[model samples]
Target: MVLNVDNYHLKSLDNLDVKCDITKVRTEVIFRQSNEKIGHGIIIQSKHFDRVAVFAPFSGIIINRIYSVYVERIPRDQQWNEQESGTYWFVPSNQIPELVPISKYSANDRELIGPLVGVVVSKAIRFAFVWSPSLGEGICENHENLVIGGWIKFMAE
Candidate 1:
């Protein structure tokens, strides 16, 4: 339950801003981490009550690996309206709020730190998406399919 991504980069709000430099995304929860590049494992589920979510990658569309992610709903309490605490507010994936994958974790039980999707945008907001599962439907550009920059975890109450 540790996904502390906040290297604070910017630019994302409506023109589907495509800048780039999401701190060089390379997951494994940020390559076994040492200092920054936060992210430990992933988990998601709400009504059934399993929570631990984090996937804060954003850069418009990192080459179809579907970059723009900002799904956050952790041990936070409240903050969701003009939210800008540590900053990271890209938005457009249809205002992202619909994901579901229940379980899957690994640190070395067999080299598996992928699959961990999520959703539960209510009990204080919860949204998720952990990638690098070989980028199957990771993401691509958008027009009608909707993937066009996203960010939506706000907590501070």
Candidate 2:
């Protein structure tokens, strides 16, 4: 399914409910003027998963607006160095056409948000995403009772 931000209010993370419909996620979108368009560094934080930051150049994103969430399958050839700090990946402004959407979420409904389903190991690193009916979603670092197809990254904290 295609998600368009125009349907939702472009509000900042501070204006949304942290624990209700939006769940455990908190966001920050830092915009810069690029050729008369708005580019952004989008940070999505949740006590349950690893912190994810995405940069979109000339993305036309407005600060403090709520956008839908879509998780796309990362390309196997994509260079993601887990051992390195300050690493980033870039996607075109029209991400829907370029990447395969594996999951989609609407921030306005807690019921639609996906649960942590499973874990995967890349380069000997374990990643986990967890979800609970009562506790919501979280990242699981260590291998525990994992099934398959979950969300978030497990951290060592």
Candidate 3:
């Protein structure tokens, strides 16, 4: 499956009925172009096993994006740090053949987007894409319940 970020608009969560699981929350500090401190990138996971969704604690435009793939099949002793290895091979979104407009994705390619990359939304939300041989690729924001609602709302627009 492939996901095309260009197809969606970044909507504000003020009106959304979603509730983030604060207990599982993780955060990363963000900085502006001027090197000023901005809000943290808040990551909230769902309690339900089947759902995934991520929220932007603050708003900003996507400044950069990189596709990450893991080479973990290699022996553990031979494996390099997952972060360095995965990101080292990251191709820019523009360079990726799969990161196209949503309408351009075939049925099989639709879900491929989740595991391909991390998006840096300037001073906003940043997502880290991780891959596992057993689990395949999925967006970090895997909220089954909220995903359906969000997708429905996103599609309606």
Candidate 4:
């Protein structure tokens, strides 16, 4: 759980209702199924998010962006630190393929965006992605969960 210490309150994301369809639908129907190509991912935030690509839910390798979000902070340190930080991931929209408008979301919605990486040590979340030898990866609705080591990726490697 690379949750922001000072930014992104979890409640802002929990049960965040976005108008997915113009008409209303059951909550169970919306998230119960994996909605095809729209997989989930963790939101990695900074004072500024750079070189980030915002793909259209359908197109790929698009040079231009449909939308972009930028935040500023002390220079970003892409290095792998010994301390356990949060893992980062990208949630792709299955139907659109390349279209994922994370930037279009308000700060609260962005906070809800996170990769289902192993376990989240923070208290704000309930769902987590746990690792297993047989299952590879699975979701567990538990907070303060820790992800097993040796599964995450860093730019250094």
- lDDT tens digits, residue span 24-67, model 3: 11111111233212122221111111112122222332222111
lDDT (C-alpha) at residue 119 in model 4: 19
Tens-place lDDT per residue, model 1, 22-137, is 32211222211222222332232222112223343323322212122233223233343212222221222233332222234332323233333311112212322322122211
Model 4 residue 1 CA deviation in Å: 11
Q: Whose TM-score is greatest here?
A: 2
Q: What stretches of model 1 exceed 4 Å from their correct place?
A: 1-111, 115-141, 149-157
Error of 3 at 121 (Å): 32
Give all candidates' CA lDDT scores.
Answer: 0.25, 0.31, 0.23, 0.25
State model 4's lDDT.
0.25
Off by over 4 Å in 3: 1-80, 83-89, 92-99, 106-110, 113-132, 135-157
TM-scores of the candidates in the order shown: 0.17, 0.29, 0.16, 0.21
**Model 4 weakest 10-residue run by lDDT:** 23-32
For every candidate, C-alpha RMSD to the true structure in Å: 17.4, 14.4, 18.5, 15.4
| Deviating ranges (above 4 Å) for candidate 4 | 1-8, 14-57, 60-62, 66-87, 97-157
Candidate 2 lDDT by residue in tens digits, 1-157: 1111111122243422332212222222222233222134443322122333455543445542334332222233655542242222122244421221224433432333333321221111464443322232335443443323322233223
